[model samples]
Target: MNVNEITPFIGLELSDASYEDLVRPEVWEQLVQGVQERELVVVRGIELTPQQQIDLAARLGEPVPFLISKYRHPEFEQIMISSNEMKDEKPIGVARVGNFWHQDSSFVADPAPYTMLHGVNVPGTSGHTKFANAADVYDRMPEEWKAKLSDRIGLHTVGKRLRIRQEHVGLSVAEFKALIDIEHPKVEHPVVCKDEYTGREYVYGSREYMDSVLGFDPNENEAFFTMLDGLIHDETHVYTHKWTPNDLVIWKTRTTYHIATEVEPGASRTVHRVSIETRRP
Candidate 1:
């Protein structure tokens, strides 16, 4: 297989390989290693049916079950469908699942370490997946900023995400938060986290999930977190992928953050998402 770099810090696109080759143990191991080394892996020119996608994802890692009931595939509970197409006056799949910067499952105490997306149908113009390397961002931080974040912990919340998502779709955040407290008060995680696999440190903060930072007053927390967000999104540390059909991409959750861009209205983009059950270090 041939590998191409999209950016110096983040993406490596693998080509000249088939789906059959990807499922092999040796290729899978190499793919995993590539993802760890580059933070993001994109394999092109492979197509898979829904069942094939599910089975293949299982070979790579445990496919975490879909939390959103409405988005679950009819046959596979572990596969979540993201699409804008409709059938018989009803939505065929979930659209705009994640519009903000986040690492999948970051709101939980044990966040998933890997997230994979298999592109079934993607728009050529828009619908890009943007990635940010937190490790590199942290490495480039000013000394004082690094020192300030050394002892700080971030308060993350799932409820806030649900609230924001509901609000985005024209629902009341308060009503959604009251009906279900799936994500309770909040969870505390260190601002600076060490990746167990790479032995590298990264600034781990999500603007969508982080409620506040401990040891800092409200204003200070806001300012600091905002600055950190800017750093994480800095162009030098970011890579945006314009997906093609049958492309499969995976990113390490602990060392990177990603967000989905808006697709054109009336356009459909569908992907089967899989998240590894292994906990982030």
Candidate 2:
């Protein structure tokens, strides 16, 4: 296998490995190591069926289904479908999700430590996923800020963002409310988290789900988020992955924040996602 760095710190691209080679224990171990150290790994030019993809995710960790029930694959609960396609005038999958910066399942008590996406159908003109290395962001933070936020906890919920997504998909207010009524547990995590595997500290909250930092007033929390946004967006800490059909991208969730760029209107983009559950450190 050949490995190339996509950026100085954020992404690694692994190529020249066949499906047979990838399923080997030693090769999978090296890929996991690459993800832990580089934050993201893109395996290029490999083909796999849906079952094969889920099997690969299982090798990494327990494959977990997404919370959104409607978007999950009908046959395989472990896979979530993100697409712009429709069947019989109904969306086949969730459209335009992850357009904002956030971590997957951050509001849950046991968040996924790894997230993998297979680009099944990609638009030629656009459709790129951008990632920011939160570990690097924490390292570059001001000492005073670090000291203040080191032990603080962040309150996270799917609150308003759920409403936003509901509107995007044209769901009625009543339907939207019913989904939120299902009693999602309140979640809180350290603003600065230490990765159990690598012992690296990273910023753990994003603007979407993180309502506030515990013990901080609204103004202070807002200021903190604003500062974090700037640092995460800094060119040195960011990597943009242009999607191609059959590209399998995986990233260490605790160490990075990601967003999907807008695709051209009427463009078709379908991606299948699998997330592996891991307990919080």
Each prediction's TM-score versus the true structure: 0.90, 0.90
Q: What are the lDDT figures for the candidates, one per model?
A: 0.80, 0.85
Model 2, range 29-104, lDDT digits (tens) per residue?
A: 8898889888899998678888999999988888887778999988899999999998899998988799988887
Candidate 2: 10-residue stretch with minimal lDDT: 159-168
Residue 176 displacement (Å), model 2? 8.9
For model 2, which pairs clash?
Answer: none
Cα RMSDs of all predictions?
3.1, 3.4
Q: Indicate the residue-level lDDT of 174 in model 2.
A: 83
Clashes (backbone N, CA, C under 3 Å), per candidate, total 0, 0
The per-residue C-alpha lDDT of model 2 at residue 145 equals 96
**Where does candidate 1 have its weakest 10-residue lDDT segment?**
162-171
Model 1: residues with Cα > 4 Å off, grouped in runs: 163-183, 279-281
